[model samples]
Target: MHIKEFFSPDHTRLSFEIFPPNQRMSLKAVMASAARMAAYEPDFMSVTFKADGSGGDQTIQISNAVSEVMGIPSIAHLTCSGIPKTELPAVYDELTENKVKNILVLGGDSTRELGEDAYLPYAKDMVAYFRERGDFTIGAACFPEGNDPALSMDEELRHLKEKVGMGVDFLTTQMFFDNEVFYRFLEKARTMGIDVPILAGIMPITSAGQVRRIKDLSDAALPDSLLRMVDRFKDDPDAMFDAGLTFAENQMADLVAAGVSGIHVYTMNKPAIPERIVRDLGRLFHA
Candidate 1:
């Protein structure tokens, strides 16, 4: 099913983001994890693609399995930065063959140099390419906090508006800690006429190491409250895990109360994190 169909005035949808296994983990293990998460009955699950484009086949295989074998809808992430134009057809053919109809296009890490044959440099370009084909329900990423530190907020929203205008069916935000930041972003996006359904991405930071990694990878503002909690429990592994889960639960509860379109959890291949969330949120999902 197209992801857009999941949006409605009656209920807020839920989804999860997972990635392909790395060298250390076996494909069987990751598939087992996917099956466990699928048992939660999310609206859909998204499988991430490697930024370097080396794991596209694994991504396809997992997405196919999630949709075909697990009986759950899936969104396959496709990064355009490292994929050449010549190789695009094979990728499309594989997705078609697997009956994977949903995609989230991204202009992966900008630090990586684009190859000579790379034609799609930005997410907007990929949106246009898919718009012309009219075959998939396309999703693109947005940052409540601007993705590029160099660009002004006006510039960022203008670029987002242009991308959505090119026929993006929906949008998922970068994981954020502050709900107020997401609220402000929602207001600005609506004022700018970005009418598509937007899903708030939430990541449950389970360890002190994850806090450090999040700081290094994203420009998302870490709230003072979260910092304090992490700093207080930084040395205690078990306490840190509980604190992080509580923080995420409260964040999601607030988002749901405010009636956001949906919540997308970055599961990090750990079903227990989202399981805790679902258990906590309980009837809030239906209310």
Candidate 2:
């Protein structure tokens, strides 16, 4: 189902994100996680794409399993970072053949070096490229906190407006720790007339190492409140995991109470995280 059509103001849905396993041996465990997550009855689930496209086929296969076999709608990530412009149509065809209807286009982390002829340079270009084909429900990424300090908030908002103008169906934010940041972003986006269902992307910070990944990915500052938790439980794996879940639950509860359109959990391939959140939130999801 197209996410735009699936969304309604009357019902707030929870969704999960998973990345394909990097090793062949890990595939079974990842699939098992997906099955456990599927039992939670989330609105949908998404699979992350590899920047190098080496695992592009695996992305589609996992998305197909999530949507077709597991009976949840799915979004497959497609990155333009290192992929040739000519290769996108085939990727779209692969998703279409697999019965996948949603896609999240990202600029990805890789440096763009796909020969001199590759023209699709950014997420906006990918959105426009696939938009021309008029097939999928296209999603784009946004940053509540500007992606980099070099880019002014105005400049970031301007670029985001351009992406939305390129026919984006919806948006999911880069994971953030503060709800206030997301609120400010929503206000700015509305003022700019870039209206679309914005799913607040969330990652359960289950380990101290994930804090580094969050910083590297989005330059998101760790608030002192969360910083203290990490400091207190940094050495104890079990305690850190439990504290992380509680922190995420509180964040999600506040987001839901504030009426965010959706909550997109960056599950990190751990099924238990979302299951626990849904269980803890109870019917607050649809409230």
Candidate 3:
């Protein structure tokens, strides 16, 4: 099913993002965990593409299993960083053979040095390519806090408008800890005429290491309240987990109360994370 059809003005939808396991982990084990997550009956599940594109085969396999075997719609991430344009036909054939209907186009971390002729340098390029390639539903990423710290908000919004104009069906945001930041972004996007449904990405930071990684990766604004809680419980594993989960619960509750289009949890391949979220926000999701 096209993910766009899941969005409604009256109801907020729930979705989960899972990644392909590394070489040491067996596909069967990840599928088992996916089965557990599927029991919650989320609107859909998205399988992430590896940064270097080494796990492209596994991504396809997992997405196929999640959709065909688990009986849920799946959005397979297709990255343009390491993959060559010449190789796209085979990948598209695989997705078609597997009956996958949705794709999230991204320009993931480059595994090799790129020159001027790089296949698809930006996510927008891939979105346009996919739109012309087939009849699949396409998704693209957005940054509520701004993807590049150097780019002005006007420049960022201009680029985002161009991307959505290139036939993007919807957008999933990079995770942010503050709802107000997202609200401001939504207002700007609406005012700019980018009216597609935007799913708010929520990542539950269960460990101090994740906090450090988040700081290094994106310009996601972490609230002082959350940082204080993490600093207080960084040394204690159990306490840190509880604090992180509760923080995510409260954040999601606020987003739901505000009637956001949808919530996409970056599961990090952990079923327990979304399990707790579903348990705490049960009525919000059902409402």
Q: What is the C-alpha lDDT of each candidate?
A: 0.86, 0.85, 0.87
Clashing pairs in 3: none
TM-score of each: 0.95, 0.94, 0.95
- Ranking the candidates on TM-score from highest down gives 3, 1, 2
Give candidate 1 misplaced runs (Cα > 4 Å).
Answer: 51-53, 110-117
Cα lDDT over the full model 1 = 0.86
Q: Positional deviation of 129 in candidate 1, in angstroms?
A: 1.2
What does candidate 2's lDDT look like per residue over 172-228, in tens digits?
A: 998888889899999999998888999998888889999877776676767899999
Candidate 2 residue pairs in clash (backbone atoms < 3 Å): none
Candidate 2 vs candidate 3: the lDDT winner is 3
Backbone clash total for model 2 is: 0
For model 2 the local lDDT of residue 157 reads 91
Checking candidate 1 for backbone clashes, the offending pairs are: none
Question: Per-residue lDDT for 152-190 in model 1, tens only?
Answer: 877899999999988898999999999999999999999
Q: Could you give candidate 3's per-residue lDDT for residues 52-164 as a string of tens digits? A: 34666778778889988898899999888756777788888988888888999887775745554757778888888778888888998999988777898778988999999
